[model samples]
Target: MSVQHPKESWLIGDQGYPLESWLLTPVGAPNTSKEQKYNRLHGSARNCIERAFGVLKSRFRCLLKHRVLHYSHETSALVVSTCVILHNIMTKAGIMLNEVEDEVAEDFDSPNNAVDSSQYIREGERTRSRYISTL
Candidate 1:
């Protein structure tokens, strides 16, 4: 039998993470102008994504706790999609969530990041560098 691996993709991560080809982290202590620019741009993109998640969680308290949810992956996906649709409807109806009290944000990334194939690492690096150059 043969297995099919995922195609190469680029993902941005923050500090304290190992540099993988698929995951690109901001250059720590960026010395060169290009590196500094990359960091600035990457930070801006990550900030927008974080803010979107915060807003989603604020509106849908059900999504606040990840470990508490025990649904299958498909069910979880449906729940999130429903929440997003409902949020849009509420927004259009001029409804807004009263900010929840000091609620801690949940981690949203998948927990299955153990793919360490050398081929993937090399491809991920090429993808990240190419993507960054265009940014």
Candidate 2:
């Protein structure tokens, strides 16, 4: 459920984060039904993001919490961005990273390959419904 923008990706955040064009956040106290649904979808998306962080840390040791990045703030951010980009490329190609030497496996699929439209819709609806019930 990544938001596609002209220059960058859509980033979903919680209430504490500042609102920006690229940043989709939930309303603290949703009044309208539409706002409530938006909150549910935003919450569901954030759940996916949190799970992605877990997977990212597991796949890349540099992102592990125990390892402190001694780089400057901007440099550290760049390092993280680089790692995430690599992770996305590897995942798209179905490349499993077991060890340093294992990363050179044959690529399976292209990142731009088409996938089932319904599968994505069903998954999104399921995620949203699951989030709705928990509220």
Candidate 3:
């Protein structure tokens, strides 16, 4: 599948990934009202992504908890792709996912994964600042 997005369009990312023209990251610390507002809005948007991942992992246990598939990188990719395709098919077919217990689901939101140390891009900083000003 091919996807096309405008240059100005963005994907919300956590602080693990650096800010980019097409990827927005949260402000490190909000010292002003505008920065605080921006951080709030940015966080709200980012949570949607986090929640989506949580749901995906909840539906497909193998993707996160089980770690049952041990294969070459290419094979692993194929496995993930297949799972995603199956997920979509199941969703479209109205197959309801079994409700996960709160205790089990709580682990999905744990911040145990290491965050990548990506460098900040100058243009991305400017874009973020401009957007915050508008807010």
Regions more than 4 Å wrong, model 1: 1-11, 15-24, 28-31, 99-117
lDDT (10s digit) by residue, model 3, range 1-135: 545769668786766666776777777766789987887787666666566656668887777856767888779789878877888899899997864433212222323323444444776778888888998
Q: Per-candidate RMSD vs. true structure?
A: 6.2, 15.2, 6.0
Residue by residue across 1-135, what tens digits does model 1's lDDT show? 544446655566666454566677665555567766787777776776666767888888788876355798779889989989999999899998764344322222322344456776566556756766675
Question: CA lDDT of 57 in candidate 1?
Answer: 89
Q: List the residue pairs that clash in candidate 1.
A: 21-124
**2 or 3, greater by TM-score:** 3
Give the Cα-based TM-score of candidate 3 against the true structure.
0.64
Top lDDT hit: 3
Question: Candidate 1: minimum summed lDDT over ten consecutive residues — where?
Answer: 103-112
Model 2: runs farther than 4 Å from truth?
1-10, 88-135
- Provide the TM-score for each candidate, comma-separated: 0.66, 0.52, 0.64
Cα misplacement distance, residue 26 of candidate 1 (Å): 2.9
What lDDT is obtained when candidate 1 is compared to the true structure?
0.66
TM-score of 1: 0.66
Q: Tell me how candidate 2 scores on lDDT.
A: 0.60
Steric clashes per prediction: 1, 0, 0
Best of the candidates, TM-score? 1
